[model samples]
Target chain A: MALMIAVSLPLLAALLCWIRPFRAVAWGITVACLTLSFAAAVFIASRILANGIAIGIPRWFEADGLSILVILLVSFVCTLAAIFAGGYMHHGSQQTARLWWFYCNYNLLAFALIVVPAFASPNLVWVGVELITLFAILLVGFENTPTALEAAWKYAILTLMGAPISLLGFFVLYWAYHMSGGGTLETWQGLYASASTMSPNLLKFSFLLVFVGFGAKVGLAPMHTWLPDAHSQAPTPICAVLSGIKTTVPLYAILRLLSVILASPEARIGNWMVVIGLFSVGIAAFLLLQVRDYKRMFAYSTVEHMGIILTAAGFATSGGEWGAVAQLMNHSITKSLCFYTAGAVLVVLGTRQIREVRGLFRLSPFAGGALLLCSLAIAGAPPFPIFLSEFSILSAGLRSGHNAAVIVLAILIVLAFIAIFLQVNRMLFGNPEPQSTPASVPGSVRTAILIAAAPVVVLGVYIPGPVHSLMTLAAQQLGGH
Target chain B: MASAQTQLIEGLNALDAGLILLTAFAMVATRQVQGVMRFFIVQSVFLAISAFLIGFNRGSIHLLALGVITIGAKAVAIPLVLKRTLPDDLYERREINQVINIPSSLLLALLLAIAAEFLVGPLVSASTDPVVHVNLPIGLAGILIGAYSLVARREAIPQLVGILAMENGAFFAGVAIAPDLPLIAELAIAIDVILIAVVIGVLTRDITRTVGTTEAATMSELKEEPYIWR
Candidate 1:
């Protein structure tokens, strides 16, 4: 029931926002709906912790440990991003008439993001993922600027093209399940159980097809051309959602299918996944060095974190699975916080270029302080959640006897770390640019960032018992043990 | 009598497959935006016909409903949505200014088709179902060719049509293999495709209004620039 409320509240918010009278109050409605949805997600997570699974409807809407983690992150990031948007969208803009539409589309995107994980069947999962992609395109292009539209177009084509390829993959998977004498009701758990009986060739083919198709949406290397563009070009709130959970949503689908594939006795593609994941990390680490725009820099960081999670999952150990899910949670929280801080700076400075700003610490203390805090957190610094998750992933790789992968990943992570700090060090400390004055950060933006920072700070030092158990259960679902 | 019915369905499916592939090629070779749209409609009709033929052979109500839904969504609804949402000038414009020329694109599309055939060869060879034998590889080819058209075309409408063409290709194979797939999934997928069309159509209109050109290739502002650290 909580899962159902978490899913439906966004749709209701969207509908309410679309009504003429609610136009003025769209932001409030969005924030309230999302906050309540987050509460429902927490309720569902707690229920999963107690029962090991929460089923809203049998064979329709279910939240296992893995999905509950994703749902929690989605709801968390969304509620905060909505709060940030409440103030950020109101900044530097006179176009209040269309603000309701932004909130409406935002609610719709939130609905799509939350629904994908709660879905039971892979077919419905595909539909959910497509809806997420379509809604994201609308949000990415919401600014209506030339660059924003181009970003949306590029984003739409690249990701939408993957739809058919993955659709074909899903059809093949269905055919394979039927060939293996499975029932008509095809769910992830059902496939995972029956995977050993399925043909390895068809299983491998479908997984590859889906991986190649969904890899684009995941912003994995080579197909990651659109990630920085869309992530940087969209409104900062949307950027938070895109980088934070939007990329994670499709990746969650990929991981679910991968879990099924891993359950099969004959299929062993973990090594290839490791290689691909490393390749994405390597690409993003190098690209991070040369990014002129700070927003794009954070955008590239999303690609890097996604690569790290994929690599961790590729380790295919229980430890690695735990690390992967932890990294997923940490990255979503920290990256969204990073974008909120970046959005606040953009609002104050009216610039995205890394070279344009100097002595940010002296400019607006709130935005500057938030930027410093999030950059440290996102760069995998100690006393931040990302570092703990990343460290566990590296140790898990070592435990899996993947010394070479561990070495490569460690080096790439360090390189990315240096790259991030190099750019941020320039912005945060230095002589202030002439003619720049201190700007006042919005109350709502400050509140959202401070609230978002709580988990990033707390989870690094302490792991709650239920959350740890949830991670363990989620790790088990990956077929790692 | 049933065997005869199966044979007839298989034979007609083979014909539809050919026509679908031809329309895919036409979408690649066509110069005019209107021409690409027409080929897409033709391809969708052939897709619906293939679904109906397969549904008849299997006597699956799901596939039959899927057939009706495919025609309603792809053939009628998508085109109507595109025309309604996008401006007339976008359709009237010619010379799509592709990345690759018509002959080269046709040649490359042919290669993509052949590649898809070989790519799906192992799976197709294992399947004893006659419909799968015909539909799977051809459906894959349709996807590859549609992807190619998407890459080659610069115009907004054709690019949108290119995406729909790929979905049509997927359904072309899906109706054969997953004929018993649930009615709800099928309906949801149909609705999702139309939503794609409607969303992309509106986005294209916005692009044309804001960017002054629907040429997606021309917009190159946001890209990686080689920056040197001083």
Candidate 2:
């Protein structure tokens, strides 16, 4: 019930906001609901961790370690984003109706994302994720600016193209499970239980279809053309949520599928995963070098991080699993912080073009400092959690006898690091651009930034006991630890 | 699960395959948007006929209800909606510009029909009804042709027609594979198709409003930059 409430509160808030005449009351209701959902998610996670049992209401709701981790991430990030939106919306020049629409769609998207991990059925889960894409299309095109609309349209078309192919793969899996006489079990469990009896050729075909289909959503190299445009064009808060949380959640679904396919002794899905992962990492790293938009550069960074996580999971070892989970958590926190800082920059400078803005520290120390810290965190600098997680992934790769992969991944990371640092340094230390009229910086924005940033910094230095155990359990569920 | 019921299932499957072939042929041959819409109406009527046939053969009351809804909503109401929305002046002129000539496309459709028949023929040949061995392939060919129509058409309305054609093929396939999928799932899929049609209609109007043309190629201004970020 708590899990369902955590997912539904935002939707409820959206409806309230829609009917309410006053904007202030709508913002208040949204914040209140988000705060309550955040509390509920933390409580649910603690309970799941304490009991070590899945809590679910059959087909409607489920919370295993994987779902719990994602719920916690969504609830936590959305709470901060809600705070940021309070300030972000106020500063925007858009009309009240437009702002209301943005808020309503944003909350609905949040609601859909929160429930996605809890769905026990793959078909329903795909529907939930597709709904998120639809919600995001509205949010991305909220400005109704031509660029924004184009980005939204491309996002909608490309993502929709992936859906039918993925559904076909799901249908094949349903047939395989039915033929194997595992009709009662739902989705992942059913497929995993019958993996040995399934036809190898059919499993391979299904996995390939599912991989390319979900891979498009994951923003892997060849299929990643939509991410940067949509991320850069969307409202800053939406960009933060998209880059930070939305991209990673779909990966959980893919990983679930991969786990099922890998359960078969004769299947070589892991090799395919590794190949795609390396390709994504190498391609994204090179692309990062040429990015003129700082937000887009950060978006590419997400692609790189996703590749690292996939590469780690592809190793299919205990250490690799742990590293991947840690990497995912670290990437979520770090990327959210990066977006928070980017939002602050956009708020202050009113531009995303990298060359047009310089010496941000001279203008607003808080925003500049946050950007520097986030850049360092994302680039895998010392004392940041991402560095530790990436190191673990590298070590796991070495231990798993994937020496060639480790070397290539290390080179890509190094190149990405240099490219990112150069851009960050240019913006932070170069001659200052002419200062324009400063927008009123909201206290809520500051608070939200602190809320999101402090975690990345704290986790970089330390991991709480419960979080550590939860990560381990999540990895174990993937047949890793 | 009875042998008599199974024979009824095989008969319904054969009818489904024939409906699918007709949908594919309609999709490939149609030129004007109104013509495509008319073909869609015909396809929906065939779908309703197939559903009613299934209901009669199996004595499944739910199938009968589905037949009613399919006929009322799809065959009657949706076509009325399409007819109202489509411009009468444009309906008189055939505006299709196929990359391949009619002969080639028809030949390709025929080849696809043959391939689908051969592919699934052996699988269903041992069933009580031999007609299913032929009908299943026709249904599969309809789906493939519907997809091909979507790919070939540069206009918004033709694409919408193609999408509807594709759904007909899927419905045909579903009847062949799992005739007993919960009524709720079937309703949901049906509603989804209707919603898609409505959405495409709205988008077409918006495009016409903006560019004064519904040709999809005009929307190419939204294409990706060669050096896309990230």
The true-versus-predicted C-alpha distance at residue B96 of model 1, in Å, is: 1.3
Off by over 4 Å in 2: A22-24, A184-187, A435-440, B1-12, B37-216, B219-230
For model 2 chain B, the run of ten residues with the poorest summed lDDT: B221-230
Supply fnat for every model shown.
0.82, 0.03
Indicate which candidate wins on lDDT.
Answer: 1
Largest DockQ belongs to which candidate?
Answer: 1
Model 2 TM-score, 2 decimals: 0.87
DockQ of 1: 0.75
The lDDT of each candidate is 0.90, 0.74
| Every model's TM-score | 0.98, 0.87
- Residue A67 displacement in candidate 1 (angstroms): 0.7
Error of 1 at A45 (Å): 1.3
Encode model 1's per-residue lDDT on A63-93: one tens digit a residue.
8989999999999999999999878889844
